[model samples]
Target: MKKILVPFCLFLVTLAYSQDDLLKSLDSTQTEESYSTATFKALQLVTLQTTKMPAKKEFYFVVSHRFGTVKDGFDSFFGLDNATTKLGGIYGVTDWLAVSLSRHTLNKMYETGLKYRVARQNDNFPLDIVGYSVADINTFLEKDQYPGLEFKHRMTYVQQVLLSRKISEKFSLELVPSFIHKNLYNPDIERDNQFSFGGGGRYKITKRLSVNLEYMHNFDKPDFYKNPLSVGLDVETGGHVFQLIFTNSQSMSESGYLTNASGDWGKGDFFFGFNLYRVF
Candidate 1:
């Protein structure tokens, strides 16, 4: 609730901006520059379920720090690795589609992805939902393991759909059904090569901010596998978006982080991360 209060207060502050009263003052006068300013100002006024509310063009950069054990070296290194930093980017095209590229500086692995809002054309419900697909190539891994097995070392792919509906002014829910595939699998080490399901939600405290929670469950194996649950917040100010969040997973990439998150929230292994979004 502490997170909700700050933005709710800011929402109230926007109503009274230096005696201009942004909510009450509107210059109905029409001009080329006036229409441009009005359109931008209008879009900036609304809080959106999907980040893809229309824009001339959109660009976002997200940086995060992880304060938990690195997944790969946990068993061999006794899990004493230092915390790591990661950076990511997102670009919007035509307001219906967006492309993203992200990488972790620690291991140099990169992920390229895309998100497209298929049915955003409908006006009744905001954004209906969004669909995103990602393909990850683990550059840190060896190119060839077994002899003549070069084809098996290709990149992994994950596809997910984020469906959300606003229940009320202060409440919303999202459902995410996901699929993950690995071109190369090790039988001795146990990995999933099938589909998965997840869901998430948002609760708005004001017009410009909201809290988020999401969970994903894998149905392949039960003994060594665990589900991932995350809680985060989204805040919008002018052209900037801030996401402050905490979660049990720390892998940083969609394929590495979301699928293979081994940290347990009950064990006090959660970490803090922030996403900063800006457009030009």
Candidate 2:
């Protein structure tokens, strides 16, 4: 009986040691990957783009309106009577890719664009980076207005690289380097290519509200054009977001606002505007 008991005890000790060794090996081989998210709450922060993208299969419908300059005072109902509007929709094809189409009333413009997340901020990354490109077609121009207008001349292209960082729970900022090309340009006044730098930021004031600001400076703006500047507030309500904005730019498209904005904020030449976004 003693001999049988000694053998069983030895076997039990060996099994316990083997199990411990196996657990240590599994722990050594295990790896964990980390990811960060939500650098911005919306795809756009006022007139500037953000690094945010919708989840796969999600859709967003946006309606934007910019009224005439407040210089008209109450005569134009604070610019509401002479408003330019845009209707747009965005869809997420994948977790990191989104496509959008929009129509603007100002130039009777049609725009199509896509945005991709190149990289995201994580424990190992410093900033979130995104790539965006758009093509705009001006359909309102009549052949009679420009005697030699061609089909290709009506198109413009814009590309941008967005870099964003969330410095704190309440603050976020982004920088954009943009290139714009117009197929047709006025030989005496306008150039075919333009470059601009844009900066925007958001500061959270509450759980559902934030203050936003955006500015774009064109390096080769014509004498008649002024840089664009916008300030606004973002109010979130579940599936909808309402943006109340004041901007110097009358045009809503990137090609139009970045290069052709003519108003000055200091001179009370800014327009009152708002953007409504509904997600489905």
| Candidate that would win on lDDT | 2
lDDT, candidate 1, 1-280, per-residue tens: 3354466458435533544333342333333332211111111111112423444377766566665543435552423356666677777776677777878765566779878765431222233456778887766665455554563465888887665555566765655666778777676664647555666666776778777777777665345555767787778798776777676666666666556666776665565666666666
lDDT of 2: 0.86
**Off by more than 4 A, model 2:** 1-33
* lDDT tens per residue, model 2, 186-213: 8698889888877899999999999999
lDDT of each: 0.58, 0.86
- Name the lDDT value of residue 246 in candidate 1: 72
Candidate 1: 10-residue stretch with minimal lDDT? 36-45
**For model 2, where is the 10-residue window of minimal lDDT?**
25-34
Number of clashes recorded per candidate: 0, 0
Clashing pairs in 2: none
Instruction: Measure candidate 2: CA RMSD.
Output: 16.6
**Candidate whose TM-score is highest:** 2
